[model samples]
Every structure is written in structure tokens, then in C-alpha cells.
Target: MTPPAIPPPGVFGHNRSLVTPHYAMMPPAGILPSRLPGFAETVVRFQAAPALGARFAQALLEIGAGGGTTAPRDDGLEHFFYVLDGAVDVTVGGQAQRLGPGGYAFVPPGIAWGLRAEAPAQVAWVKRPYEPLPGVAPPVPRFGNRADVPRDTTNRPGRYIQFLLGTGDLAFDFEMNLMGFEPGSHFPCIETHIMEHGLLMVEGQGNYLLGRDWHEVWTGDFIWMGPFVPQQFYCTGWGPAAYLLYKNVNRDVT
Candidate 1:
């Protein structure tokens, strides 16, 4: 849908310097507190589940007060979750861990695991079975919070952005990073690469050109694009629009 143009942050004119057009590429969509017994808000996009592209599958696990999910067995898919708010207890790969806001965990395929909310927690998760190659077994589950890691920015000239690596112990074909876009900033060109995307807005509003359509999105919205869709965005807010973005990295070409 073509979103309405929200006036730039605050008043116009001389005070304009204080006001800025806010914009951001968000993390996931429909990530809200849940009414279910064991889940809260959640937004899980296709980019995070590359193996389950547009499938009639349940990619997100939302929990509310006293909410949670039973220990599910391998459905031939990998499992990953990042906490956004509150906390939740996760049991994966025979290990139990309590994840608070900013915490994260990943369960490899074939390993049994379950999840439950502590109070009210928001988590973004993905389900895609590990692609097992000959002589290789699935890796162990991983757990941690944002504070447990460091922010790594891609030192591209003229771009100011910060991100964090998962455990940095294993190599992932894709990277999910918290992206930032300041007022009046932009991703210069329509990125048309082999990588697909699931951009979720965590904060701010902006204009995004996806394929041939210009879409305006705000916090809580999501955009999924197929490979080579030629998409770009412009930030029009005072504060930078920050969102957890997912995209394949170090991918192979045909």
C-alpha cells in the first residue's frame, strides 16, 4: 500500500534544522505483543528464512504472558530467535537458557527445542533446516545478547552504520544486522544483486522504491523482495531509522 506522507518530524522553516524527515528500514513486521499464552510481538521475514521462501510456513513464534511453544522436533529447518523486549526461557539442543531483551539463540536442524515467555517478550525468529553437506553435522545451538558482542560497521565510504555479528564463531551465508539510516540519507542505487531481502522497520518512517513502486513505510512494517528486485530507500526523519535487516552474504553466483 502507498503509505500517507507524514510531515517531517516537527515544525517547518527556521525550526526546520531541529526537525528532520525521519525514515528507516525496519527489522520485521507485525511484531507486536501477542494474546497467546506464551508469546509476544514478533516479525520473522523471508530473508531470515531463505530456505522457506514464500512457503505456507510459520516463521514467527509470538508469545504473551505465560505464553510459549512446546518442544518441536526437526521439521527439516533451522531455528533462530532474537529477543526484542521482555524475556523468555528457551530450551534447545538439550540446553536451557533464559533470554532477555537483546538476547538471541539459534537451534540447528534435528535438535529438539522449545520456548516460553517469562512475562511479555518480543522475539524475531526463523525456521530453515540446516543444509547438511557430506561429512558435516549440524552445529551446536548458540545463545547471547547484543551486549555480549561488538558492533561491526561495513566501512563503505560516506556511509555511517553500525552492526553486530552473531557469535562470529561460525560462517553464515547470510548476515542479519541492525541497519541505520539518518535523515536525508539513502542507499544510492537500486541494489539488484543475487541477494534477496527482508527489511523490517523498527523505528521511523520513509519512502522506499521497491521494484517499480515507491512505498512509504513506518515502524512495524516489513518489505520482502526477491533477488534483483532493484530496491532502495531514503530516510526522512530526524533520528536515524534503525532496524534489524537480513540479507545473504558471501553468496555464490550462478
Candidate 2:
């Protein structure tokens, strides 16, 4: 479904941003509240700090056909784009690729990447600056469709996960991956982590622990977390619950 264009942020552009002292909940009331430059035929779920108390930002962006970014973009932040519906063409680092649902592209910091919507498309836009490691080599651009990637459900029998970039050699300061839970399944314990998160629900429904509250979340919902915010999930809907997760990694305590 092609999403309707949203009003751009006002000249003052202050109200769209907010600071959730503890946590925030955005149920599927079908409202996307924030908008800024660098997009077209798109609506944003939310953006960076003061609103969510996080250093990084993630937005649920929907682009209509023939609508996309204004130019090849490179903002010196590592970025990832995961397609949720329709199709898109991305050209980056001398490589151009077309992605349908479940396709993803990773462009490392400073690489030129451009996007065009062939069909109306919804995407998860995740961004954060790289925390450089002195000895590790710089990362490279990678493009792939998740259908071709392994879910590797062996060790994790009933559940499924296709790790897009959580591994030994990826050399990134953050991790972005896909996770699924069978209906009625849940985490055994609450988890507290130093890495903050930006989670976008792609499918199903569930109750999630955020800070001190449990909020109902379903497809099209986005959740942000600051450091050590208590978190966990329980799937209660008719089908599996799945989400694309973004979390900072490979960094140290200040």
C-alpha cells in the first residue's frame, strides 16, 4: 500500500520531537508524527534524541512509486535500509541493486548511496556513527535478499533468526538483525544491556517490556531504548511475531 505523504516539519520544527523520560509507546493508531528533509512520499515514525533519549535514530519510512531520496547520500554515519513492502532500487559504491520485500542494503559511513522507489515501499531506516576500532579494517557495502540468507534455526529450535550483520568479522559498531518468535513464546528473563536499541515490528503482535512498563505492540510499531532499559518480549497473537532490531555494539563504557 502506498502511504500518503505527510506534512513536512514546520519552519520551527520543534513539536515533532519529544523526550520520553522513561519509555514511549506508539500503537498502530496509524499515525506517524515526525518528518524532516532527505525524503519524499514518506512519513517518519520518529527520529533521534531528546525524544527517546538515545544517541542513534530509526524511522519507519514509506515511499511511493517514483518517490525517493533527493540525492546520493553520505552523512558519515553507518546506515541500513530494510525493505518491508513493494520494491526499491539502490545504487551504492559503484553497485546498484533492486530489492523487493525482505531485501536489505548496508552502506558503511562515507559511501555514496542513492534510493529510488520502483513501487510504493515501506522501509526501516537505521543510522548511527561508527565507533572506530584502531586496528580493525573498515567495513564495506553489502547487499542481499534475506530469502537467500540462513535462518539457522537448529540451535534455536522453534524460533527463527537470520542475522543480517551480527557476526565475528562484520567489524561494525552496531548490530542489525531479524528475529521471530512463535505465538505464545517468550523470553525466559528480562534483559538489561549497555547497548541501546531501535526496534521496528515487522509482523505479529505482543506485549513488550520497556523500562518499567509493558506496552502492546504490533506490526508497524517502532520502539526505542536507552542504555540499560529493561527489555523482553512475549508473543500473544495468532501468529509469529517478528521484528528488525538495531543495537549499538563493539563500544566501551565512557
Candidate 3:
């Protein structure tokens, strides 16, 4: 077998990590892995957090086979998990389910949950303090695969969206969605919205306009957009570009 190619030695190297008051872009090449408490044989890279001006935290987790939490985690926060590859067994409130690629789970606050990898696995994890609304009960745990969600293509040609969680329910304070754009497609207009967003590029490449600057992003990159920061995307690869998006909704602005 031939040896793997290596880059020529250089005095300096470049990376794609950017941060501003309005948004942040964290490329996979700039990831810094660390171990988290309660987990074994797992590495975590946090993409967004309150320290970075984000209201929530999102992390990428890489788990070795048979590795997992020592006990159920119940931290009084809502949690969302999306499997990117391999298989994982997830337990929520004593109920267990096996999640493969494209699988996702939503655990509401107060529920105990844990996960163990059936194989080497990569997962996206999001956690935030639960915001309760008067007269509206908290949402229950939800689990499903992206394949089961119907794609809504009526918005625009070459663009589609899949809502991982129900949108019509008032009990839900936030939503996670899978948005896809065929090559050469773009958002209808630059969006300047009240909702802050945590986004993970899951497929292909795109040029993202965030708060007046355009950045080239690829699969495995993560972004966090603050509220009212301008944002848009234009697909620019041979295949479709897609992202997993998180946005807080269904609550009044204080």
C-alpha cells in the first residue's frame, strides 16, 4: 500500500474560524475536542454557547463503540440530538430507542436521558434552558428519522424544508428543521429575522451571507446567528446543500 500524502511544511497555516457580534462560523478544520463529564470514550466540540453570545449550546459528539454516559442526565434543560453517522441507543425517561443515521430525538426538560453508541458514532447535540409559557404545557419527548418527515417543496423551486418537530403545537418553544437547496439555488431574499439560529451544514457547500459578510461554508461546519442578524445562503456545489437549523419560536418577545 502507498503511504498517505502529507502537506509540505509551512511556516504558517490558515483556517476558517470567524466570530463577530452578529454571528460565528466554526469550520471542522478548526475544531478543538475535549472530554465532557459523565461520558466515557467520547469527545465533544462545542460550536455555540452562552460564552459566545448564543442563548443555547450546540456540540458535536464523537463516541467510540460501547462508549456512553455513566448515568442518565437530567439537568433541567431541554435537549435535542441528531445522529450524523453510525448507530446509537438512546434512553429517555426509562424508554429506549435505537437511532441510526438521520435519526433524531427531542427530550423535554425534567426527563432523564442517556446514550450509548452501537458503533463509532457522530451526533449533534443541542441543549437550552426550558422557557415555560403560561397556559401552555411543556412538550413531550419526540423521536423520529428525517426520512419519515415529509419535505415541503412548495416554498420555492429547488428548495425544500423538513420540520423535525411539529410546528403547529403551542407547547413547543423551538423547532429543528432540515433545509435543502439544490445546486445553484438560493434563498428568495436575505433574511433578517428576530429568531436567533444555530445551524450545522450537513451536506455539500454554499456561500452564506451573515450580517453583511459572505463566507464559504462546507459540510461539517457550524454557525450561530444572533437575533436580527441578516442571513441567507446560495448553494454552490455539484450536489444539493443542506443544513440542520435550530430556532426558538412560539414565545413572546420580552
Candidate 4:
């Protein structure tokens, strides 16, 4: 009788599962800790890389402790924020807004925005330029929380996550989603495609395969993957691992 292959240690084992390539996974890069005034005891990062064919840009994100605030600084990219926990006061384009868990806000490029905290708050924000189409005007800045909006699943089932395609009403090269993975469940497939990704694990723990490495990620962990990086996930922590997943999807050039 033939001997069994020495599979890897993860629950999924070593053999890579292949699918129709709905999306590609990238090897996530870890960001270091930094401090800013009003943002003391906070973690900040600008996650961007050349391996993913990403143009010159930055992703300004932050996770904060109790009573932390982020002062306004200009990097000149359109800003978007999603609040993971707690509350904060955000002034965008001279307008004031209060953001709570699941909250979101957009700050126009070149516009001045300031952040202040009333309690403990955790926020994830991204900055991109307002690209113009031939005839479409740049969109007005939008602000709200995830709870205020309805969670939409994909057209097909079994992926087990809420889907929000930013391209639904705009022109872009990516689709952003809040992926909710149930504990003890499985992704079951090694996704390979052309898209790059940024996944911030908001809750729970899971074994994730990124490129040639299998990583265990928990809450407050950020995962950045390059294009065509083979990957999958299996949740194992106390609760489901909910992450904010950003994927670079091809969009029409007008």
C-alpha cells in the first residue's frame, strides 16, 4: 500500500484547493505601531505596496484605545473611515460628525478633517484620490455607520460574508467588504486571482494561508496580500473572525 503524504499542520492540510478565481489573495504585510497627538496609545498605518500594481497612494488606518484622538494632517488622498468600536467626533470638510462602532465617514482629498474622541474608539480609514471618469462628476463625500445600512450578500451563496461593492455606484478597481466568518467554518478553497487585498481582522482568530505562509490572525490584526497570492482561512477562536476585506477588482476605464 502507498504511504499517505505528510500534509501540513493546518486543518485544511497542504494541498491547495482550486476554484473559479472569484478573487485573488495577497501575502499580508504587517504594519508597526506609531503615535500621534490626540492619538496617543493608538496604532496607525498606511498600507500600500508596489507588488500589487498599486499606483502611488496610501491607506491611512487607525485603531485606538480609550480617549484617543487623531489630529488633522494632509496627505492629499480622498479619505474613508470605518469605525470598529467606541465613539469619536470627526470634522470633515468643515462639517462635524459623530462616529460609533460600525460607523463610516469620507473626507474629500485636499480637504481638512480632524478627529477627537469622547470614549474608547477603533477606526480603520483608507485614502485614495478622486479619480474622474470622462463624463461622471466626482462623488460627494458620504458618511454613516454599517448598522445604518443593510448587509447585502453576494448573488451566490456559501461564501458566508456581507458584500459591499464600492464599484456598485462608482468607477474603481476594487470591492470592499466586511467579511464575517463563522467559528469552526472553513473557506475550503485556495483563492487565486489578479486582485490585491487588505484584510483587517476585527474579531476572533483563524488560520490563514497567504502566499506560501500560513498565518494565525486574531482581532486587531491587519493582513495585506499581494496579487495572485494563494490563500484560504479556517476560523478557530472563541467567535467568528470578522474582517474588513478590500479587493482590487477590474473596472471599466471611461
Count the clashes in each prediction.
27, 1, 0, 6
How much lDDT does candidate 3 score? 0.90
lDDT of 3 by residue, 1-254 (tens): 99977765331395567899779988876778999888988999999999999999999999998887847455799999999999999888778899999999999998999999968999999999989988878998889999999999996899999999968677888899999999999988899998889999999999999887889999999999999999999999799999999998888877
Per-candidate TM equals 0.70, 0.84, 0.94, 0.70
Best-matching candidate per TM-score:
3
- Each prediction's Cα lDDT score? 0.59, 0.76, 0.90, 0.62
Candidate 4 TM-score, true structure as reference: 0.70
lDDT (tens digit, per residue) of candidate 1 on 1-254: 99978666433341211101121222342233334332334322332333434221223455667777764444766666777778889888779899887787777667777788757666776554344444544466778776666555455322344334453333454456766677787776777876656666667877778666667667766666656777877887667676666665553455
Error of 4 at 96 (Å): 2.4
Name the TM-score of candidate 2. Answer: 0.84
Cα lDDT of model 2 by residue, 43-63, tens digit: 666544545677877776778
Candidate 2, residue 93: the lDDT equals 77
By TM-score: ranked, best first: 3, 2, 1, 4
Q: Give the TM-score of candidate 3.
A: 0.94
